[model samples]
Every structure is written in structure tokens, then in C-alpha cells.
Target: MDAVQVVAEPRRREILRLVWDEERSAGEIADRFDVTFGAVSQHLRVLRDAGLVTLRQDGKKRFYRADREALGPLAAYLQSMWADRLDTLAELSEAAERAERGEGTDT
Candidate 1:
């Protein structure tokens, strides 16, 4: 699966966030959630398959870390797309606030 499709799963997204800045063992990653270690491992496998993470083996432990450089293209595209959407959301939210305040009423 592609990086975008792999990350579309919220659990996988959470896992990504956990290891974004540092490598963590499979057990460590599993501890962050209530799910089974196998479940987290599966997510890591998906991420690895998508080139979003790198796995290292160390004496019966598997460590996973975010492979951000590998996702440069997708990240750039997502940033551009979200920047516009986030700006629109902010504007709409501000408009709602103004309407809720009755157009600058002194109350």
C-alpha cells in the first residue's frame, strides 16, 4: 500500500506519531495503546511496506522509526493541500464566532 493509504488508518497514524522522532521497540510501541502487540506489529509492517518506517532488529527486539525522508513527496503534497483547507477552516470558524457574538454587540 502507498504511504497515504497506509497512514489513512488512525491506529497507524498514532503509531507513526509515537515513533516520529525516535526509534521505539515493538513492545514500547504496543504499550502506548490498549491493543495487542501483534496488532501494533501489523501496523508497523504496513508502514514498512509503505516506506514510512525502517525496522531494525536487536537481540530479539524490533525497533521502528519514522522514515520521513522517504515520504518527502507525499508530505509536501499533503502540506500544500492542508494549508489551504486549514486556512478555510480558520476563516469559517472566525465567521461563526462573529455571528455568535451578534456582530460585535457590546454585551
Candidate 2:
């Protein structure tokens, strides 16, 4: 599957986020989510197949990390989208705090 299709799933996008900064073992990745190990494995497989992630095997464990170079333009797009969402979340949180302090209403 192409990178776009592979990352279309929410779980896959989150997996990418988890590995975006550094390499993580499959078990570590699985532990971050509430799903079964097999489910996380499937997502990893999809990411590996799409060349969106690089996998390394050591002894009995597999580690994964995002291949930002492979993602090319998509990486920038994802970063922009995530930034926008975070900005929106920050705005909403500030608004909630203001409301709690009774300072959000006009007049």
C-alpha cells in the first residue's frame, strides 16, 4: 500500500507519531496502546511495507522508527496538520480555563 493509504488509519498515524522521534521496540509500541499485540504488529507491518518506517531486528526483538526521508512531502504535511490541531487544542483549553474563572463572557 502507498504511504497515504497506509497512514490513513488513525492507529497507524499514531504509531508514526510514537516513532517519529526515536526508535522503539515493538513491545514498547504495543504497550502504548490499549489494543492487543497482534493488532499493533499488523500496523507495524503496514508501516514497514509502505516504507514509512525502518525496522531493525536485534536478537528476539524488532525496533521501529519513522523514515522521514521516505515520507518526503507527506512528512511536512503531517507536521503542519499536527501543529494546527495542537494550536486548536491550546485555544480550546485556554477558553475552558477562562470560562472556569468567569472571564470568558462579555458584559
> Which candidate number maximizes lDDT?
2
lDDT of 2 by residue, 57-76 (tens): 99999999999999999999
RMSD of each: 5.1, 1.6
- Give candidate 2 regions above 4 Å deviation: 105-107
TM-score winner among the candidates? 2
Pairs in clash, predicted candidate 1:
none
CA lDDT of every candidate: 0.84, 0.93
Give lDDT tens digits, candidate 1, residues 3-102. 7788788888778778877999999999999989889888889999888989999999999988889877766664565578779999899888999987
The residue ranges of model 1 lying beyond 4 angstroms of the native Cα positions read: 76-107
